[model samples]
Target: MRVTQMLIPTLREVPAEADTISHQLLLRSGMVRKVAAGIYTLLPLGNRVVKKIENIVREEMDRAGGVELQLPIVQPAELWRQSGRWDVYGPEMYRLQDRHGRDFCLGPTHEEIITSLFSQEVNSYRQLPLLLYQIHNKYRDERRPRFGLLRGREFIMKDLYSFDKDEESLEISYRKMYDAYNRIFSRCSLDFRAVEADSGAIGGDVSHEFMVIADTGEDAINFCSECDYAANMEKTPCHIHEKELVEEEGPLELVATPEARTVQDVASDLQVNTEQVLKSLFYNVDGKLVVVLVRGDRLVNETKVINYLGANRLDTADSEEMLNNFGIPMGFAGPVGLREKTAVTILGDLEVKCLFNAVAGANKTGYHYINVNPQRDYQVDHYGDFRVAEEGDPCPCCGAPLQVQRGIEVGHIFKLGTKYSEAMGATILDEHGKEIPVIMGCYGIGVTRTMAAAVEQSNDENGIIWPAAISPFDVLIMAVNQRDELQAEFALNLYQKLKRAGIDVLYDDRQERPGVKFKDADLIGYPVRIVIGKKAISEGLVELKWRATGELIFKEKDKIIAYLQENLTAMKSSKR
Candidate 1:
């Protein structure tokens, strides 16, 4: 594509709303433009990048035996009701009523629709296993969408679903999808890891997220230093190092804390270790008021609480409701005196239960109970792990300290089993004539997010350093000055030669300054750049520069095509 003919709206300044590097650069580089807050219009460059990423996902899925088929983006509410997700899918789904007053929703996912299709079509054991996939736009009304394509409400996605006869057959299907995911990301040249993750609202027992490592990522991952154990921080299991309880348990005594409200304030004012303070948090979990206790230094993982209770939603208790209904102030809530409020259930962390002589609130203003023991001082309805896993905590599998990493999730695969099929009654007849629900597995790749993540991990200060497989173009041919006859002739010849050799080449033939052309070339981040200068053209040679490595080599005009072909072969082999 010629620079003069194509729409590469390069910008010299960054926009105010662009926060992350990918977001800032894509906008400044003219790859994308904002349509709304989390929505964007993909310009020519951005569209090309997204298409390349989608093609990679398509190739890998097809190789894994997936048949391509498109599903409806707008689904009937009746279908969701059959899967019991109509009310469960919360506010993220965009719901609407047609003119006839039938409820419908823009699909954030297609599980219910796909399952309903399978239930009606496949009813025999002969079609025991099936792999189907589609690439399309997904909708989600993100409460606070940011980071450009990373969290857009309307974004391109590749979703694949598998149907199998039994658990063993489902395992095979899951493995195939997992292997395909690895190849898809690998082909995109992403620096990523596949970590075990919670199945969130997808309602599965096992899941894994493919995360691209970046400093600006939103997801936190915990990896063991000594083993292959890796998982999302919210899902990582902790082996709490047991500390000996105070052998001589001290007596519980109430003291005037004056104005100590926060855990830090109370710990510092009383001159006690923060670990000795039991921080209490009141929550309204699915309409049930629950009290939770954790170490002062630890944080509550709300996902663990939500999954543990099997509730669709979890929220903190309203400050006004707590004070008005239970006479418990926000910062002063504790288990003590809550026995009178029988509606409130108390759940404590496993370590909190064994703590002795801990400090807790008196459930009143400016008062606290010191040397407070768990069983004697306060009652706990249950004991379990409720705190977020932190760095330096021992891994559940290996007793080594966990290393925390920041990563952007690009893909996820789940062993959904019969969650959707059973709910929707999607069953097939067995060989013995017995009917059974179809076992399922789901796989998804955020195509646009993967492209943005590639920019996140691979770019430098200049611009995006795209990989050869997923770059908008493999090579960029530019002349020092389009008006210079020798330089222009050499550049045009090289461009045509590379194109004939099956290389995707971008020819910059605009009458622009050499500096501007070079800057734009670097910003676009084509893998290989071939420069035709007055000196090289006179010498029958051209200069080749590596966008990623910043290495420059000079080759004769006749042999440069051969050199590029050889380099491209090596690049393809390395991705494999």
Candidate 2:
């Protein structure tokens, strides 16, 4: 493609609204244009890159025996209702009325549609273990869609679903999909890991997310550098250091703390470690107040607390609710000496129960208890892990040291055993003519998000350095002075030669200065750049520069094409 004929509007100034490097470079390089808050129009350059990624994904999916199919973006509300997600999905689903006044939704996912389709067609267990996939547009009503394509209301996605007759077959299908995901990301030149993840509302026993390490990512991952164990912070297990107790008997006494509200302040006044402090928080779980206790040094993991309570939903009690329930302010609430008359369920952390004498809130302002020990002063109904895992903590798997790394989730695979199939009544007949629900697995890759994440993970201060496999153009050919007829003729000849050799070439034939062309070339970051300038033309040679290594070499004009082809082939072979 020639630059003059294409819409490559390179910008000199960055847009104010773009906070991330990918977002700024994509817009400034004329790759995409924003149509709405989270919706964007991909220009020619962006579309080409996305198409290349799609092709890579398709190849890997096909290698794993996945058959591709196209599904409707707009699905009937009845399908969701049948899956029992119409009410459960809440506001994230985009629902509207059709012309006939029937309810419909733009699909955020296709579990319901796929399950319903399979139930109607497949009947026997012989037809089980089928994998179906599609690359299409998906929509979700994100309340806050930031970071460009990373979080969008409408974007392209590749989703696949597997159907099996039993749990054993489902495991096999899940492993196939997981291996396919690894191959897909590896081929895309992404530095990623498949970390254990919470299934969330999807309702699954096991799931893993493919994360690419980046600073701008939203999810926090706790991984062990010594072993192959990693998990999302929400689901990561906390390992506490057990402290030996000092045998001493002191009566629990309430002393005047004098305006010490926070745990640190109270611990400081009492001359004790923060671990010797008990922090109490009131939560409203199903309209009942529940007190959650943990050590002052640790932070609460709300999901674990909710799971321990066996509740579907929970929220921190408001100040007014706390005052009305316990007649104490928010900061001064405590679980000491509270009788069973109060409709509050007490949950204490293992660390809190193991403490000898801990300082706790006195239930009165500006006062706290210094010698209060659990079971001696107050009692809790249960004890479990409710603290977030911190850095330098012990690894839950092999007892190795832990490390924290930030990563962008590019793909996820889940073993969704009958979560949707059973709920939607999708059952099939076994060989013995027995009816059983189909076990299912879900796999997804954020197509556009992977593109943005690649740019995020592989870039320099100049711009994005896209990998050769997924670059919009494998080679960039630029004539330093297009105005000069000799330079223009040389560039055109080289462009045709490269194209004839089956190379994807972007010919910069625009009448621009050498500095502007070079800057733009580096900013767009094609894997290899061949420059036809006056000095090189005089020597019957051209300068070749590798974008990733910033290596420059002068090669004969006839040998340039061979050099690029050989280099690309070697890089790909090394990856395998």
Candidate 3:
């Protein structure tokens, strides 16, 4: 490719709307352009990088015994209705009506279509343990699409669905995909971790998300300090509280605590330790009021609260509703008088019931109760794990402290059990000649997001540092002072030689300043740069630079081709 003929509109200034480093660099390098709030058009350079990632995914998926196939992006609403996800997916699904008024949706996933296909064709155990995959466009109506391709409403994705006759067979397919994911990201040179994750709307028995570690990531991940336990912050345990139950404590006393509405305020006003203050929160669980008790320093995990309440949604009781509808003071509601409401239930965290002499709200406007004991003052309907996992909290597996890191999720694999198969009546005969629902597993890689996340994980202040395996081009032939006859001759010779040697080379033949050419070179982040300057003509020495390390090495013009061939091969296959 030559700069004079290509659409390499490298920009000197970053766009105002580009938020993350990847977004800014992508635009500045003339790789992608914004089409809408969450939509983008991949330019020549961007499409090359995307194709490289796609090929890697295809190679790995095929190596794992997956047969590549194309599924429709437009699916019938009846299929989703049969799978019980038509309404459950909510507004995120891009639903529409065709000319005949038949309902359809642009699929964010292909589980329903895949299940329907299986129901029609795969009916016997002989066709069991099948893995099929495809790389295609997926659509989702994101409410707020920011961060470039990271959360785009329309993007490319690779989805692989597995069907097996039973749970045991499903495990074999799941493990194959899991190992393939490890190889795919490893080849991309990503610093990522596979952590336990909630299935969310996908609905599965177990799932794992592969996340690339980055400071600008949106997901919080908890990792064990001494073991292999890693989980998404939404569900990692704050660990089981093991404080012994105090048999006796100071007597209960009501104290004046005017305007102390928050746990910190109460702790400060009462001159007590934060751990010694018992805080109660009012939540509207399935339209019923429930007061949850925890230590002042602890935070509640809403997912745990929702699971405990067995409800689809869990929301904090409206502050005004606590006072008007329930006659409970905003910050002064306590479990001691909480049961009198009859309709409100009291739930306690494991640590709440073990407090010795804790200070608690008094259910009055201007006062709080001090030296209250849960064993004597309040009745807890249940005690369970309900607090957010915190830094330095003990690990659930090995008892070591945990650490939190920000991460961008790029891939997810789920052990889906029979969620979709049973719902859609996708059944196959068992070995014993009995018809049973097929067990399934879903595996996905965000093709576009993975490309952006690679930038997030591997870039410098200058611009994107694409890994060798996924770079737009393997070599950049930079002609310094292209007007100079000697420089142009040397650059053109080297560029032709590289192309003849079957290398993806980009030639900078445009009439531009050396500084402008160098800036664009770094912005594009080609792995190897060959500089043909006056030195190449005068001393027969070509300047060789590695984009990743910025290492400069002088090589004779005659050996430039061989040197690049050796180094480029190693770089593409290198792990780091």
- Model 2 lowest lDDT segment of ten: 567-576
Candidate lDDT scores, in order, read 0.88, 0.87, 0.89
Give lDDT tens digits, candidate 1, residues 419-528: 89999999999989999999999999999899899999888889889888888888999998899887888788878888998888999998989899889889989999
Candidate 2 structure quality by residue, lDDT tens digits, 1-576: 888899987787898889998888888777888999899999988999999999989998898889999999999999998878898787889999998999999999999999999988988899878999999999999989998988989999999999999888988898998898888888888888889998877878799999988988888898997998999887888767776766784788888888788988888898999988899987888777788899899888888887777776688889885667667776776778655336678998888878877788877778887778878788888988988888888889988888888899999999999888888888999989999999999999999999899888888888879888888898899888888889889989989999999999999887878889888888888989999988777988898899999999999988987898899867543542
Off by over 4 Å in 3: 245-247, 286-288
Candidate 1 overall Cα lDDT vs. reference? 0.88
In candidate 1, clashing pairs total 0
Best by TM-score: 1
RMSD of each: 1.3, 2.0, 2.0
In model 2, what lDDT does residue 79 have? 92
Q: How close is candidate 3 to the true structure, as a TM-score?
A: 0.95
